[model samples]
Target: MPDGQEVHYGDYVQDDRVHKAVYADQAVYESELDNIFHKKWIYIGHESQVPNPGDYWTTWVGKERMIMSRGSDGAVHVLYNRCPHRGSLICNNEHGNAGKAFRCPYHAWQFYMDGSVRQVPMKQGYDGVIDYKDPQFSMVRAERQGNYRGFIFASLSTEGEDLETYLGQGARAAFDDICNRSPQGEAEIVANCFRIIQHSNWKIFLENQLDAVHPSITHHSTGDAAAAMQKKYKDKTGDDAPMGYQFLADFTLPFEKWDSLQTVGFPNGHTQLTGYMGLRPRDPVTLAHEAALTDAYGAERMDEILSTNVHHVIVYPCLSVQPPLQQLRAVRPLGPNKTLTEIWHFRLKGAPDGIYERALAYYYHVNSPSTMVNADDLNNFRAIQEGLAMVGGGDWVSLHRNAGQDTVDNGVTHSVTGMSEMPMRNMFAAWKQFMTEGN
Candidate 1:
């Protein structure tokens, strides 16, 4: 249907705008999967998801099904989820303990947690027919895998920059900020996560993550209602309303306030938005958490850790991390017009229960599929997909907001205004490079 012609990345991507075909063309989407997701460091499940030997969580890397398993030796292994024998999926459920090894439900061919061949059913039948001990008979391991803090990422291709070099300072700060907040300097994933199938391209979701201008307009109703209720509750009870109300109310912030914030973009497409939420309150729970942090890390260190003002960090092409809130959303592109997002929340290892509760509140109130905030975003994503598919109105999606006004320092670009489209432009620049260079 695409005239059997190759889609040129340069023809579609421009300095301040990109063609809608990038979002709606099947060929472009397939190219993105091959050139970007498969080649880049895509996030797998967190190490905490499989804390014990034989524990595993299934996820996707590009179009490949993958398993993140903890081996008996206390090492985490990323393996192809497909069984070597007959090529059936080894783990059907999202996550479960495989006990000692993974056995293919189809053929009973067993593989170790580290993806080494353990046993083959009826080995005598294949004595001369095939060598079951060959590595080919074992579940294939990922070409490259790395962990930052507790988060795990795997690249299908062996070639490319190492994980740390790829992450750069901006993305590294995401994990550092989250883990450093805890007294134990560690964070653990919650048992389960919220999975969403957004009816739009994955890039739309990522673009919205740092889009400072859309919140006050797209979420105006929800924010206004929450702010009104916050006042009503305060007037009635003579006390501050719960943080949940404040979370929604913050979206009603004026455009000037949003513009005052700063967004920084890295060469690798990672971007960060300065924090807008007041996370450090003088409440009893906050004070208790601060005391615990101060005891673990001296008073000055605690202040420095808590003072890191980052609201969201996009580990481009894969994860959108809100370090301050302990929230991460991983994007899996299902198709040109479909995307899957896995929403996960983390708990500070030695933080006060109230701190975890606060993260939980944000998770349920903002990130969960049932929340109005998420629903609004989902609706917009679907609408955007539908609109981009049309041929009449416009072929280009504008990224002209505050264009050419960004400051560049040492290869990183800093937006002059938070409302600038620097993040989107930064991402598309990386997209073009990845698509054209096949990196």
Candidate 2:
């Protein structure tokens, strides 16, 4: 791009095999920041994160630091963190209640939650040098921003489809599964989250979200340990183990079951992995939660909502969600081989506290950075990046498993089997389009 040279994406991304350079090259990384991450709708913090007026959460859109804030009017706003005067960060911390205004740490330039300049210090200093009335002096907002089901997104580029259109049905189904479980038909964000910096390309993390092949192979030890613990608990207490242990034990499920599960890839690179492990076990706590849902929406609707099993949803290159468990991960690509993922879980607003506790257990044991499950996945991602650095390790990574057997209807790609590589190929198809089409 620097020399006006064309990037033949086909060289790196074939139908089934992707070249290593796409994951390792610095130039490719720069191009991704420009063409993919910046242009596409990237996930920001949820609306519940900054519920109170003047409350703000700091985040990133591509490499640029950003702030998501709630205004006095109760409207959510996203803005670049930089002060227009000297380009210093307005909110230095991750998130905090800026009660009245966002006063710059570098200087006293103040800004409203909506990014308009509330006041500029020493108005006489720029009498002739600048136009004080111009909106340019205020914080720069993202070119476009939208929220769907309380999830917030911001795009640096002014172009592209609206957020709802971009999310497609697969992603919409995920949000519905999450929200419909709550009697109030909404979910609230849990304050704290686990932040992990994975040493691999960002795309690799998204690819692994719906990948059903790696769980049994990479997480075998963790699965066995959990299963053993579960057995020990049942034998000693003469009662079934908690759902937490069962969650990990399911990872040891045979490949046949994984293959039976379905994977659907939607447009704009979003994809979904159908539910495998049954989550709706009958118990006192679960029954109470189900009763609450039933009361809110009646038996028939509650049955339809509870029966929709969604294991995972990847809102391509930005967010990975487990709507059934009320957890999602937001990805931030720091460099070619470095990615920051924030794992956040939610509480079903009107459901019983026990349900939130169940979600908490999954958040801690499965997605947390210290957990064996996530650690194993991170190690594999790093290893793949490291291997790509080796000259003789081969040039392309294969996505040939059941590649041609996928079904395509109405622009959606449905894998013939859950273990098929259709998800990877589908994502690359999007990657190639986002890179080549508009450039």
Best by lDDT: 1
Residue 399 shift from truth in candidate 1, angstroms: 0.3
What do the candidate models score in CA lDDT, each in turn?
Answer: 0.92, 0.89
Q: What is candidate 2's CA lDDT for residue 302?
A: 86
Q: Which consecutive 10 residues in model 2 have the weakest lDDT in total?
A: 1-10
- Which parts of model 1 have CA positions greater than 4 angstroms off? 1-6
**Candidate 1 overall Cα lDDT vs. reference?**
0.92
For residues 1-439, could you state the per-residue lDDT of candidate 1 as single tens digits? Answer: 2223655676788889999989998888989999999999999978999989999998898899999999999999999999888899999989999999999999899999999889987789998898888888989999999999888999999899999999999899999999999999999999877899999999999999999999998999999999999999999999989889999999989999998999999978899999988899899898998999999999999999999999999998999999989999999988999898999999999999999999998998898877878788889999999999998897899999989898899989999998899999999988988898852
TM-score per candidate: 0.97, 0.97
Give the per-residue Cα lDDT of candidate 2 at 358: 86
lDDT of 2 by residue, 127-174 (tens): 898886579888999999999989889999999889889888977887
Candidate 2 residue pairs that clash: none
